[model samples]
Target: MTPEQVLVAPGRRHVYWHSALTVVVLVGAACLAHRHWPVLERGAVRLAVADQGWLLVGGTAAAATWICAALAQQGAVVRRLPQGRLVAAQFAACAANHLLPAGLGAGAVNLRFLMRCGLPAGRAASALAVKGAAAVVVRAALIVVLALACPGVLRFPRLSAGILAAGAVVVVCLAVVPAWSRCRRALAAVVADFRAVHANPSRAAALWGGSLVFAVLHALVLIAVGQAVALPLSPARVALLYLAASSAAALLPTPGGLGSLDAALALALTASGAPGAAAASAVLGYRLLTVWLPLVPGLVVLTVLIRSKAL
Candidate 1:
């Protein structure tokens, strides 16, 4: 390349990488590693759980959400695979995500599974992409609901500035969404074929309803975790904090989003007036509930698949 071209390319590449690193660092600092221990005491855990029964309810709902998410994607290409198989594929995809790092394991697993099941790559990719988008929209909706439902929670003086800035940036990004060439095309295409997707109202409803339920399950677990550590916090407040912690972890590509979620949850709770140590302990317990809980079921499903020579 010419000297001028090299100089310009270097600057752009450096900027791109810097921005990427910044986001990862910011998320990590905000979301990973529950460093507080004072809040996570054994006695607190025993008493906290005894006070509420939401955790069990939330777990059941989360499992159901995964099933629904799988079915939703399957409904996209009804002719290629049976409903039951599609749902199984969903569990396998999630299982792979937990087993592998940086999101690679899940994608490869899904791709191979789809190919083995006789689906064209395009169809499989499209279906998964659609389901993923539905998840994001559902998450955003959940955040908005929590924010509105608990005004006291949203009115955090310390996080107030950051919240405003983030909200503004999100708003600007969404406003420019139409200008993204591929996004525009995709939107146009989906709009064109909306009738068919809506033809089976039951499937569409399941997908959306499943989306909301999945988000609520997220809220409930965090609230339970907080309670388990003896936090006197309101469930609504807990929901908002969980929203921030989960969002921060999602921004990171870390395996299990482990440290990030722990850190974020503990810090958020501490910032809200809980002792740091107690918050940290709760976060650890919370991570076990949110991350490892799904992993067990995922592994069991994988064992069944392998034994059947499905993998």
Candidate 2:
């Protein structure tokens, strides 16, 4: 076989295997949902009679998340790209994200898009890393500010504050430490890229502002869902709970945090005094607006982008 053929052969095989794995994950999620159909049905019923106006607002918020993501992504690099295409890529990337664990699919799609837009591979990857770090930092800051302002909203296990502080420091150090000498160069590149991106005032503002707004919008979506389903918890409480649960769920390696995020959200809501049924309903509504509703269109957009070589 020619060299080209050899390379193509491995890629084809990998694609087949990845497709199979995606199918398995979808089936597993379906089965789990079936097992919880009764709860879901109850929740659905509650949602059916909910305030349509509020639900509309929630849906709008959910949709706006993609736009915010695109803005933040663009802000990650100084390179100018077509604004419309960038947002479309983010929309399509959401579907891609669901097909692989730990955001590999989304990262791959964005990396390809960035390279297509003329960024070098290393720079593209560094840009992505910077965007992710900015997001984490922004979210952490929000959590701290909210937790302090609304004390007792976040109830941790019986651990002292000092212990929690130490644990957080240790975790941060571990995450920041490079595994080997070879990786240090990559780490330094990331730092340099981060500095370069933020050096531009507009880029820095877009990156940080978009990240903060994205988090708030997501929280607002959850809060709107809570209102739609008549969740007993106050809006502020629901927003805080969502931020906490979603952050915690990020630790899981599941595709889209599918099962993990759902469970964590439900558990948090229920724990915060909402009835189990109400909590389940709120989650169902939130997912319906954010995931299930947009999934098909997102996939269609993804396929078109791929076939057209836009990504």
Candidate 3:
């Protein structure tokens, strides 16, 4: 190609990428705005009767989730992590997670953080997998414990046997499609990393403990919000409902589980005998504490961390 065409080609490519990124950001913003419009329409009136003390408690729990996330991340790897930077990364990651679907934003931030902390790319990825696996196990255990304690309160929606069979078949087919050698290598890496993390008593404790605390703190936030909004359920029951709803909603691929989680939580709360309006208010309060309130600050912190090369 001529020198002039080559020069213009680079500019055109830049424009194409820039336009693509702009479109993604705008789409994400539009989705958020659409999902939150109902809450905005109701405004402060819905929260007028909420107990300030309970709301404060909810907000505190919401804030603490980030620290728990940081601890869990640190425990995922054996390296000594800078405490302040680790927590700051989590705070920033929260904002980024909302901008991308399926946890990509947060994963990208943490992956970069791990690499910067001196881990190779593969190890960093395996560490993330280990942490995620621990989280899932802890959450599932909590759900089982709660179900056993509460008896009939934990009934799940039914699916047809044929549907279940079909799902299993689909999963098996997908698993079969991946190259056996690649899958084996990936499994080996994950297992090796998992063993390494678990071999250290402190790291194992941190991993399991942080994961459990993170899940419980999130439920506490919901429970406190329920109290603030005068939902009639017991604290234990509210926590159970939150866990169930969140587990169900996690299957959906919305950014940070935005619209899906809200809808699921509201439906679960209402099914548990809460007044529809009260359930809606509780969900709104929970989102206000966890998402909308810290969004801008989180973004700003993310920017600062990026500029400083801390992430």
Backbone clash count, each prediction separately: 16, 0, 0
In TM-score terms, candidate 3 sits at 0.84
Deviation of model 2 at 271, angstroms: 0.2
- Clashing residue pairs found in predicted model 2: none
- Per-residue lDDT over 107-136 for candidate 3, one digit per residue giving the tens place of the 0 to 100 score: 888888887788877888888889999999
RMSD of each: 7.6, 5.3, 6.8
Give candidate 1's root-mean-square deviation (CA, Å).
7.6
- Candidate 3 deviant stretches above 4 angstroms: 1-44, 157-180
| Backbone-clash count (model 2) | 0
Off by over 4 Å in 2: 1-37, 157-179
- TM-score against truth, every candidate: 0.68, 0.84, 0.84
